[model samples]
Target: MRELRGPIGVAIALWAVVATLFHLYTAGFGFYEPRSQRSLHLLFLLPLAFVLYPAGASSPKDRPSVLDWGLAALAVAANYYSYAQAFRINLRFENVTPLLWPEIVFGVVATLLVLEALRRAVTPVLAGLLALGILYLFATEYMPGMLNYRDMSFSEIVETMYLLNGMGMYGSITGISATMVAIFIAFGAFVTGSGTGRLFHNLGTRIAGRQSGGPGKVSVISSALFGTISGSSTANVFTTGSFTIPAMMRAGFRPHFAGGVETSSSVGGQIMPPVMGAGAFVMAEITNTPYSSIIVAALLGSLLYFFMILVSVHLEAKRLGLVGCDPSEIPPWREVLKDIHLLAPIFLLLVLLMMGRSPHFAAFWSIVAVLVVSWISPRTRLTPRKLWDVLVQAGNNMVIVALACAGASMLVACLTVTGVVISVSTLVATLADGSILIAGILLMATTLILGMGVPTTAAYIIGASIGAPILIQMGVPVLSAHLFVFYFAILADATPPVSVASYAAASIARSDPMRTGLAAFRLALAGFVVGYSYLYTPALTLQGPVLEIVGQVLVNVLGLVIIAAGLFGYLRSPLPMPLRMLLVPVGLFLTLFEAYSVWLRIPVELAVLAGLAYWPTLLSTPAPVRGETTRRAESAPD
Candidate 1:
């Protein structure tokens, strides 16, 4: 339980800084070949992961034991062993490379290190899952039908997993971390360190604190703005929810509702772009879609998601008869703008991305931009010491993602080796029994399940590898299919039963965990429809003509409104239970953009409009809870 001190803490800090410098150097100056680049990246991260993350939950919190340091050194050395002989390994194109004893020993060590890292950083289930995959690799032929596989020798399995172009540990994902994701994450760290988070929080409070459901709306806005920068959902929650959740409670929201809003909105940051969660970078690489295209395709869905929360908050505010925070209590916009220059780096990054710069390039210069812009204000200035701490924090943040990506790449390699990737897809297709909707549901369920325990990048990487192929087989567009799985994976954090994010927010709000989770799920219902909408009609993903995209968006926007109103039982006034039930199907139908459904939508739209005109008469008089106030202060303050 002793805190890390003296040489060991300094060593760890230096190692992380060295790693950041390595990535910064490669990102700006020149790059290594893919294998070397990624191998070195993994080597840099392996030791840091061991030393930074505890070996177990019961392991030391502040200090590393001798054994822990030794293991950390070993993990780094193993990667260096592969990296040092990259040229010699590359020459052997086939799997017939002779395994020296060191190679064999290190191979086994590398496999164990990856599993241990996964066990430490992610869940034990994922680590066990990788162990099972490796077991399958060596003993597949001994299985029953449908679970059977072609057996490969132990050496062959080792070759494929550890030594084959470093595909297992140093694959596309590792490559992404080395080149693209690390830089963007570093940019995030710099932005946060330079005071952008405070600026955004101030702006959000000033902009949203007095609106309907003021504090909740402030949370939605701040989390969205902040999430766009950090791109990690849980981090987003803890960062902004610490403020927003408390504010919502004071604004009269139930503890559970406040918690649910924070969890749901923070989770939305993963789906937001141009600097989305790390998963977006991997998704762009895996799907062969340009990062810009991915961001463009995601724009509508992300905005609609925020819009849904906004509408729901407004309705709840109306139902509760809540009022905005007193102007005397709220921060003024002018005061918040004092740190406005802190936003230049963010705007620059977004502009460069829109201009089609590669993500790494945009991120590299944005980091510089943050450094440069921080000089403008004495209050936001970054000293060398401060900047060093930023890099260390960046490295610390990158560790979880590095471990997740490494493990994911290993699982990806395993599935590809055992041919299970194709089998799982075929099995999913079979489960669908030819209905694309059924196939979509099965894949959605799978991602959500994996997402319950896995980080977004790992869950999506695994799900897309298995499920996207099945969807493509069913004629779904490549982007739409990957987007579908990715969306559901992000949603998994808010989903009930095993949602870590909901639990995190529940703790903050002092609410029931399961109830918060359900509330989050209710608020996030639009996400499910939107995920499927892109697949049913590609226009939603920016795949079709401009007119088609606009028309489709308008229709779906209305559908989202109807869905939200129904779910919460309020629209201008409280909707009756029967009307609420009626709107669900109508809302769902409005999202199904196929020609056949258009016929149903037309009549449904007319009826909805007619209902709106006569809405006042539909309900019996003495409107329940009309002008109701959730809390009454008995006397005015002196």
Candidate 2:
């Protein structure tokens, strides 16, 4: 994005403040009628997205063009129609309103604007996907196999799409985006602007920067911290990667390896609670589970995912004989931590959430607490200028997310209206026969394919609607199905070719993007496996007794370690090729044991123990290292 000068800058800034204030007011008091609240929500985002993100990279980014102004005015007119006549529209829909030309024109214009805004904010892939949703509605009767359904008329599609609570723009979990996700985005912006992000990075460096794999570990810790709030893997990469990626590279990690570590670690943010990514919010809404419950269930899974990344980087560092950063270069703990109150809002946010406040309530109060806490010290205070930046940044980030939700909702509207979602679910069940495991695998593949190249929240919206229903039909837990799709949706950012997170980190690390993506996928392997773990062992999702949950979780953690050892070719010492191959199935079998009977599990558990006993004996001879990296190699104790 470019810096707008003079009038344009002031105009954008004023609108941004108004939008933030509007949300803050409602969050403090209460929401307007659902339609009124959501329409106004989009009213704020649509115009800003057009002005901030242009038609293309070749267009002016920061300044609005004549076409942009027209889109902005159209956004106001389209959503305003819904806002102004909410009661009338509600009654009309209730009366089974017929096709109207005005509604049709508005819907056509509004849908086109939404698609274009999404194309600019996210990627063109999402815009194209959303456009297909409309086509699907009109073309459903022509679809082959289970996907075929009766088509809807064009006028009906238009009527259903134009309103605040319309099928296309408002329902199917988009409410979570308009409410919880928007507030959280603002909360994140305030936290970041108040310097809490640096505090996280500094704290990470203090804890991990002196280890042999310090830089990589620091990246994991810091990215996880920042990601919980930022929720955008690409944003997290740029924020934390600027420091961590360079530190890793300077600490002797190969550029591609460094970028991969950053990419995978940053993606972990969406899985981390108290604020998991946008997907978690939608999951809570769709599954009808408490947000706290969702977060609790996600806790173990989040740990397992990041723990594997930490272990992979450590093993790689060990195998390659990498070392920590210089002591002189490391920031002193006292200096870095002096203004730690900046993180108080995060703690408060979590506390309020655990206390059963609405997620938006918690987020609102947290933002308030941020404002209050930042006043404690001038160095950390949110000055007026800084606060303005926070509002603008919040509005900017939220627009992208809101637009992504709109695009995803277009699909949800199509699928729900056309009954194609059910057909897809039925098709999967048929393909899998009577086996739940096969059904789950098929759903995972479907979600994984659809999730790639989409935003986390949007990806989950589309993938879960299509995939989660299949698992539910197979009698799997609702939370399990949503969590399953959520995991894959977040993972799509690390998958190769179009791995946006990896590509972002690669640019920062100055590495080959595809190599970084492939390496990220490899490092994130445990995530893929664990997505299935919770399905087989409900204990992993905290569905069982406390002891059983602990036991199951521990077993899965150990299994992840064993798998990482095999894939990364290291533990205490490097494993030879054959041992690496042997360890793979040993890990896989042990994981399966947790979900199997004792008669079968005990034998598998012992087999793993046997490998554990023998691994150290066959350890490969380690090579020596040279240069600055070796200077502080002794800093980390064996």
Per-candidate RMSD, Å: 6.3, 6.7
Candidate 1 global TM-score: 0.94
TM-score of each: 0.94, 0.93
Model 2 stretches astray by more than 4 angstroms = 164-166, 593-638
Put down candidate 2 lDDT per residue, 560-614, tens digits, no spaces.
7888888888877667799789887878777755456534554565566566657
Q: Total clashing residue pairs per candidate?
A: 0, 0
Give the lowest summed-lDDT range of ten residues in model 2: 593-602
Name the lDDT value of residue 60 in candidate 2: 72
- Candidate 2's displacement at residue 519, Å, is 1.3
Candidate 1 C-alpha lDDT tens digits along 1-638: 13456887888888888888888888888789887887788888877767777876688888886777888888888888888877877787657657777777888888898888788766787788788888878778997766688778888877766877545877777788788988888888888999888887888778887787888888888888889989888888888999889989999999999999999899998888779889999988988777989998899999988888888888888888888876775778777987899888878888888898888888889888888989988889999999999988887777778888888888888888777788788888888987888999898999999999888898999999989888888889999999999999999999999988899999899999999999999888878988998778788788878877876777777777788878888877777799889887878877664765444565666568467546988754764573353323334354
Candidate-wise lDDT, in order: 0.84, 0.82
Which parts of model 1 are misplaced by more than 4 Å?
Answer: 1-7, 596-603, 606-614, 619-638
